[model samples]
Target: MPVEIKLFMCRTDNFGALLHDRDSGETAIIDAPEEAPIIDAITHSGWTPSMLLITHHHGDHVEANLALKRRYKLRIIGPEAERDKIPGIDDTVEEGSVIPFGEERIEVISTPGHTAGHVCYHLPKAKAAFTADTLFAMGCGRLFERPAPVMFESLKKLAALPADTAIYCGHEYTLSNARFALTVDPDNAALQARAAKVEALRAEGKPTLPTTIGEELATNPFLRWADPAIRKHLGMEKASDVEVFAEIRRRKDNF
Candidate 1:
C-alpha cells in the first residue's frame, strides 16, 4: 500500500509532517519542531508514532525530540554526522543508507549547506522527499554552515530526482521565496504565475507546499542558475553555473 502523509503547522513557520504505513501500523514524524502540536496532531489524526526522524540538530527541528521519545518510546533516526547533537537518536544514517519503514525504504540524501549535517529523506515508492531546510517551494535554505557552491551541488542532487516527486520541506517560507525569486527571474512566466498563486494561497491562509520537482525546475530561481535569463539578469551571462548560483545565494541573503 502507498504511504499516507499528513502536514501540519508547528512552532513559528515550521511544518510537521507524518508518514504512515497502514499495513504495518507504523507512523513516523518527519521532524519534531514542538511537543504540544506534534502530539496533538498525532492524537487528532489517530495515529501512534513509532519513530521520529530528525533531519538536523537545529533547535526548531529537534526541540521536541526528547519529549516525543519519552511519550512514545519512539526510535529516533538522524544524520550520522550530527548524531551527537540530535537528542535521543537511536540510529544514525548518512547518504546511501536505506531505512525500512513498513514496505517502503527511506533513502537518505546528505544535503549539507544550511547545516553541515543536514539530510533529506526520499521514499521512492511514495514519490516524496522530506527536504528539511535544503530545498523550499521557490527557494533554497540560506547558506549557513557551508558555501554556496556546496549548497548548489546539494540542490543539484535533488533536482536530479524524478520530476514528479513531491517535496515536503520544513518551513512556510514560500511567499517570501516567491517574492525574492521575481527579482532575479522577472521574465519567467511560470514563476510569475506561481508567485500569483502563492500570494492568493497566503491571502487565504493556505499552504503552498508539497511542490514538485517539475514545478521547481520550471519556476524556482535557485534551480535555474543555468538559465540564460537569470544569468543575464544578474549580469553574469558568461559565469559558470556554480558562480551564478553563488551570486543568487549572496543576493538572497539580503533579500
Candidate 2:
C-alpha cells in the first residue's frame, strides 16, 4: 500500500505532517512543532505515532519532542550535528544516511542554511521530500546560521531531485513567498498563474502546499536564480548564479 500523508497546522504557521506506511502500519511524524495538534492529527487519522523525525534544532521544530516521546515512546531521530540540542533524539543521522520506515527508506540530505545542522528527509519511493525550512513553496529559508552561498548550494541539492517530487515544507508562508516572487520575476507567466491559484486557495482557507518540484522549478524565484528573466530584472544578467541568489535573498529579507 502507498504511504498516507496528513498535514496539520500548529503554533502559528508551522506545519506538522504525518506519514503512514499503510502496508506496515508504521507512522512517522515529520516535525514536532507542538504536542496537542500533532496528537490530534494522529488521533483523527487513526495512526499511531512510531517515530519522530527532526529536521533541525530550531525550537519551533523540536519543542514538542520530549512531550511526544514521553507520550508515545517514539524514537526521536535528528541530525548528528545537532544531537546535543535536540531534546529526545535516540538516533542521529547525517547526509547519506538511510533510515528505514517500514518497507520504505528515508534518505537524509544535509541542507544547511537556516540552521547549520539542518537536514531534509526524502522518500524516493514516494517521490516526497520533507524539507523543514530548507526549501519553501516559492521561497527558501532565511539564512540565519549560514551564508547565502551555503544555502544556495543546499537548495541546488534539493533541486536535483526528480521534478515530480512533492515538496513538503515546514511553514505556510507560500502567500507571502508568492508575492515576493512576483516582484523579482514579474515576467514569468508560470509564476503569475501560480500566484493567482495560490490566492484562490488561500481565499478558500486552503493550504497552498505540497508543491511539486516541477511547480517550484517553474515559479519559485529562489530556484530560478539562473533564469535570464530574474537575472535581468535585477540587472545581474552577467552575475554568477550565487550572486544573483544572494541579491534575491537580500531583497526578500527587506520585502
- Per-residue lDDT over 4-77 for candidate 1, one digit per residue giving the tens place of the 0 to 100 score: 99999998899999999988888999989999999999999899999999999999999999999999999999
lDDT of candidate 2? 0.95
Compose the digit string of candidate 2's lDDT tens values, residues 146-223.
999999999999999999999999999999999999999999999999999999999998998899999999999999
Candidate 2 segments exceeding 4 Å error = none
Model 2 steric clash pairs:
none
Against the reference, the lDDT scores of all candidates come to 0.94, 0.95
Q: How close is every model to the real structure, measured as TM-score?
A: 0.99, 0.99
